[model samples]
Target: MIDDELRARLESLGGLDAGPGSLAGVVVIDVTRVVAGPYCSMILADLGATVIKVEHPDDPDYTRTFPPMLERDGADAFSGFFAQYNRNKLGVTLNLRHPEGKVALERLVAQADVLVENFRPGTMDRLGLGHERLREVNPRLVYAALSGYGQSGPYRGRPAYDNSAQATGGLWSMNGPAGGPPTRVGTIIGDLAASLYGVIGVLAAVRHAERTGEGQLVDVSQQDSVLTLTENAVVSYTTEGIVPEPLGNQHPFVRPYELFACQDGFVFFGGYTDKFWKISCEIFGAPGEFDDNPDLQTMGARFDDAVYAERVKPMVERWFSGRTKAELEALAGDLVPLSGVKDIAEVVADPQIAARDMVVDAEYAGYGSLRTFGSPVKLDRTPPRARGIAPDTGEHTAAIFRDLLGYTPEEIEELRAAGTI
Candidate 1:
């Protein structure tokens, strides 16, 4: 139970209400640990949802203990991995195995607008907090499940991560250079896609609940999300019996659609149409035989990677190796679709990124300010912002127990002593 002093402190907070965010008045319970589910909830929090994260002191979320922890008051305060996704939220420790803890979560479920989880198919069912039971508690609750395969598939119980989803969903077959062993994408595409899909599903369900007072399950599968991205390949196989393979940066249907090296930088530009291809030949000052030949001019001829690799690419390379980036910009960058490759440092230093607020500062009590990414969505009247840095493990347990759930001081104390906070 909270002491008298703590209760008084929480009561004093009542008069300091914050201005609402876009998702204002929404209550979200985040029973997620790692990337996909937490990322979905983080976006919700940025849009003004009051997110409450659940964990236990004895067995905290994996991110909290991962790495790069800040020392505060002689204990691990915040971690980079945890803070990256859990920003703008409350936190509470609940030993769900304990009777009191389960009761507390049930009470929370009854009041929540949404509940997100990333556990295996039967885990929540075993914990007695499955979607059906929670729907009984609050029919308007939007229950979201982020998982590998899904809740009712043959692979529903298989343990998976970003790599597993990428491999199984055919993303591995579409990345890297030709003839190379299949490799996962550089970024965690599987996890991020699932997160965005989860957000879309939840928002749709919430809208439905508002209209009909009927909630529904928003099921998101990482493997399924991966397939959504590789839809072109799926279509190709279905209609034409062609299995798409990695051709590095080359476009299969378009000629001259590849990266070309300049003296000072790397540029990616695709010249496909007759107009663009003629312009490309002129810019490179191709020889008469090559520039005037109709046989080599069509997209079909240049579209073959083997033919282009052997006959035409060498001439373009020699021409590009002699020109500076500024010279290329003057010649083709303006008229052609092109972008210079940027490393992380260059991307952060770009004027456009700063003006768009893609990076922002995050400050904490114990930790000094650090620069991290900001929300990507932009709203003219109600832009999203981080509510605060992430909460430490169970940081808001006391306040939430008394202020939100209406648990008495004595009961809170009893639960605390019983390891059921």
Candidate 2:
């Protein structure tokens, strides 16, 4: 039960009221920690859904203290990564190993339209929050499971991270420069890709449930999601019996599709088509060489001739060496596809990102001015925005129990004293 003062504060802040003309009625119970699952829930919360993030009472989310963690009020403040992924969420803590905690969670689930979890395959079932158990309590609930592998796969029980998934899914095998060792991408591509796929599956399940009044499980595997990005490599191995190797920044099958050095940094150039290639050659003042070199005439020939890339690199470098990033961009105009490599600072300061509202400020009581990435999707009629900062652990526990579960103050106090929350 919420204290009278807290209840008054919540009421004044409009407790459980749907945002105007929004998809605000739906509730999302996020029983996930770390990047992938929390990121998915954040997206839903941005879309006006009420997302309640459940954290472990004892351990909490380790990411809360990840590097770039701020220090505030004597405790290690929330990491920027954690805050970014968990924005617009209400947070609560529960020791799910306790029977009372599980009972409270079931009560919460009964009111939720969706439940997302990213534990290893059998963890939820062992916790008695499996799909069958959940659906029995609320048949309309869409259960989305995000894991390293699909529920029934041979590797389902194996531990995985972004790098592990990238390697196992054949993504790392086809990355890096030609003749170099397989290199993993700098970003957590596998985890993020899986999260986005999980989002799609959850929404699809929601739509189906709305139509048929039945809910089902949506399973998203990081390896499977990353595999979608390795389309041609998989095809090459299967259809042509070719073992694809890393081509660095270059396309394995397309010539002149790699990054070229510029005056300051690098510029990626891809002229796959004959027309684009002609334009690129003309821009570089190498039309004669472009016309005469038989190896450079076709993508296939250029790919086959290792000497072709070596010959063209110097010319391309010279052309870019004389031009600033802006000048080169202006010269290329709309005809040539080129982009300057942007570091994190450049990306953060980019006008296009600001104009598109890809960053927003959320208030953290302990930490002022929490700036983080915003929702990318733009809905015409129901645009999404960051609602609030991530809550402190168990911040909304008593309030939610009182308002949604109708628990009494005496009961909540007993649970708290018993260390159930």
Candidate 3:
């Protein structure tokens, strides 16, 4: 049971008057490191949850060592990678390997609405702080376990990283050029997708706990999440004995819906739809020939390898070869939906991205205002945002100990001396 002092603190902290935004009163005990789990808790923090990020005293989150380090006070400090994901959370250190440290975490859990971790299966159970044990501390606490594989299954015990998850989850098989070696998706989709799913699960569990006062486990597997994004690959094979192979920049079902080289760079066109295809034909000044050709009349027919290579590809390439990305974009509209394939820099400077507030500047102590991604989930009233800078490792340890756990300064010092925190 939560102690009287902690209960009072929780009440005060949970009140809407305590802060602004959607999740003002909720508290999260984030025992996650690196990408998947940290990203999930970061979303909660952005939504105004008081996320206390707990790390071990001896070994902190590995991302803290990631590059693009910033110097603070003339000393090498701050990792840009860690800052990008860990912002807007309180940092606390506790050596969970120690008995006192485990007890300290239990106290924090007693007052938290959520606890998220990405350790391997049974890691928490071995520490004697598994879901069942934590439920005893706080019946309404949502436990979100984000891992490479789910808690149950043959592969549950296997260790995995983003690349491994992607490789095993079937994403690698469908990427890259046809008849070429399988390629990984450019980014860490495995970890990021799992993080997104973890966020959904956490929110749902939190809502359920709010309604029935019964908390549940949110098990998000990177492999499973990646598999869901395979986009009909599974059914395509199962339903019709056709295994999907890599198609490079080409969409499997849409002709002229692939990347095309232009004067300067590339542009992606989606003129496979009949309306758009006709408009494209007219714009390219080949309306009569394309519209009249029986072989290229329909999308399925245009998608045929022979038709595309023999008739469509030559004409499309000729049309795009002389035009710049800007020129192609100028000709694009509702008639022929198209976009320039932009690099990261171009994407960062895009007008649409700016208008949508997809990028915002986050001010760190040493780094004045580094640009970072803004929340895509916009609310008219309680908008989610990166509310504040990330806490230094254990920066809020004393404060959290004093306010939430009612620990005296002397007690905190003793724990510190004992290497428990």
* lDDT per residue (tens digit) for residues 45-149 in model 1: 788677789997699888777677666686556787788898877888998888788889989888788999999888889988899999999999999999999
| Model 2 bad stretches (over 4 Å) | 1-22, 73-76, 286-307, 310-312
lDDT of 2 at 319: 77
Tell me the TM-score of each prediction against the true structure. 0.89, 0.91, 0.94
* Decreasing lDDT order of the candidates: 3, 1, 2
- Candidate-wise lDDT, in order: 0.81, 0.79, 0.85
Which candidate comes out best when scored by lDDT?
3
In terms of lDDT, the poorest run of 10 residues in model 1 is 10-19
Lowest summed-lDDT stretch of 10 residues in model 3? 10-19
Runs in model 1 deviating more than 4 A are 1-17, 68-77, 274-298, 323-334
Q: Candidate 2 lDDT, tens digit per residue, 46-83? A: 77777888988888877887767655886656788788
TM-score of 1: 0.89
